[model samples]
Target: MADLVDSFTPSDPSDKSPFTFLNRLPTKRLDAKITRAAESGIPQQGAQTGGYTPSYLYLSHVPLFPLYSDRQHELLAKEDKHKQLMIKAMNDADPDKKLTGGQKAFLGTIGHLVGAGSIVSTQRWERRLVGSNVMSADSRMKQDKLLIFTRWTVPAPPGRQRQGPLWFVDVLEQRYDESSTSSLKSLSGNATMLKVGVADGRKVTLQLLKTEAKGIKTQKMWSKGTKTDTCEAMTFVGDNEIVAMEIVARIERTASMVEAMEVRKRFDKEWLVPMVQ
Candidate 1:
């Protein structure tokens, strides 16, 4: 596996396809034994599922910094200041009544859960990776970029179905081998960095990598030397399938198309979203 990843980095950037190389990385399947070994490492015990099916692999594209710029915040604050008197008036008139637009706007600024987004929100989103199993890592990965060992013990609660997979991620910063550079370039090129909020209303930047093949689109983003409490660093790969369901509309062909479309959308929302998220 290591040899494959190491060799995957193309000698000539234009000569090889990075996505093809990445797609070819070995896919490891989990049986009862592998699951048990992974589960045993978890601090929290859970009912053992002897085996877990490999789900599809995906990359999450997150912003490198907060969504709101300093100028935006400054302007919003100034605008909110103008509404202070009105907000106070609304609060005093009906303390128990529904919140007004100004009140909501003020609250949005004060609260981290606003639609504008925040650092705390990003952190919470990142931690979602915890308790999820990582099937494999890119071969080009190493101490310089990221190093993920095949032998791992991920922590999980006993039978927490809501938890996607268990992961114990590690961070590293080292120089990549010559071959690895090509892979890195492929992942890094043209992909923009995003501004994502961190904890306590802070923000950071992240790089994006997006690739699609065989009807699967993998969008990835990365941050350097950043680690969460339980969630570490790892790329998760799983299995995804397209199920063909028959929907027959006896009266109208259009109705059948609509029904089929609805079913497909629902299928993607339910099965596909969970696998990637």
Candidate 2:
């Protein structure tokens, strides 16, 4: 069994497909294992058995930086602002106007700062999530880079039809181009798109429409109206549209941080280091 599993491993070191070991098993042997498990009242793991396991793209090996001090202070200020706004809204409510029970309850909650605090708390968690899992550096001295961690189906080996979809965590470098606004405007007027440059020189667009947050769309350059591929970077329960917009904001913030860090490094090299020398 060990030898059979080893045979399924991809020859390429970079091909970290998790299903390679199980999918490479011989048909008869694989069937027998499944049958034995069924006889023992245990289900086999795979699409065939209806057992699904999620794969995560971990950044444990990457060095992560603490949230920038400026950003931390900004979040704190925003939270305070939210609290003040909520309190003002409640106090400014028209006394002559009759309010529905739901409206009154909402006003009461907001007035107490519960609703406002929760909103700000969620924002803080989202920012921390990005800092912990998405923004990373190759080394302590390196500028932080934004990464999109997603699960993608591995392509079938050459000439062999895939028995089932095999998923593996894929790490993609997300590049932001501010100058591409004119080009993006040509795509769609209503939807906001993030044009990410992949490490392989391919352009991947993440479309966050005002109406929906379906998935990330990837297409080759200059291929307008062509069939594009879609993938999800992160999964969320309930309304994904809100989460998608938040992700776009987080990505932009991270990109800005990276840019700022680079600028500071250049300034240090040109002025501070030279003065010291």
Candidate 3:
């Protein structure tokens, strides 16, 4: 089966057409597995199923999310901002369809959540924006470069072919044997994103300015000589290329739902028990 899968190269790594390793799937059991994996966000977890959700949801499921201090902090800040806005909007609205213009602006995104077009709210909008993307020296002192991990551990979509939670990672600089443009075009999907941006010799560091808590937890210094934390100096790649983009579809969780309900239940039990007594 592995050989059979190996023989068929997906147009991209994610095509998953009916003819691919997918076809070998004995529909019912395979579907159950996929569904289970989707909800559990892992096959062994629980009553999880697979389908389309946002990239962030997928990020949440990963056992470990490794990011630089600044990047992780930025992402958290972004999520908080969006949550606040959502809370405000949900509270102020009439609950009926009679929406004011401001409410109308938010309808698209809300609708998307309930199965419409891929909508993003303004509060969380920049998270989707193609901001600074780059590729730098693995390390100047002790160089180590391998561009192969472009394929992230992000998951595949569940049922609907129409939904997309795509990603855009840009290549900032031109590196030897790397073409940012082609790489960007190659990784076209709804599950993951990669874009590239060029750095003009200025020392680049993604720093977290707002919060005191450093977001970057795990850092791999690919080279031996450098600081024990950072990977080797990032290499310049592409022709000043801001390249690569992936939008890997995410499978939202069953356990998270369970966790939420459990929390609410426990809270309610606590409150009700006190009141009854």
By TM-score, is 2 or 3 better?
2
Q: Write the per-residue lDDT of candidate 1 for residues 21-89, one digit (tens) a residue.
A: 342444122222223323232111111111121321112121111111234334334433433433344
How many residue pairs clash per model?
Answer: 33, 0, 59
lDDT per residue (tens digit) for residues 9-58 in model 2: 23343534434333344533533433332223111111111112222123
- Alpha-carbon runs more than 4 Å astray in model 1: 1-156, 163-175, 178-222, 225-277
For 34-101, candidate 3 gives per-residue lDDT tens digits of 23322221111123233323554534333221111233234334434544443344333322224456
Give the per-residue Cα lDDT of candidate 1 at 18: 37
Cα displacement (angstroms), candidate 2, residue 75, comes to: 2.0
Model 3, residue 232: distance off in Å is: 22
Error of 1 at 245 (Å): 34
- lDDT against the true structure, per candidate, is 0.25, 0.29, 0.26
Residue 265 error for model 1, in Å? Answer: 29
For candidate 3, the lDDT comes to 0.26
Q: Indicate the residue-level lDDT of 85 in model 2.
A: 46
Total residue pair clashes for candidate 3: 59
Instruction: Mark the 10 consecutive residues where model 2 has the least summed lDDT.
Output: 42-51
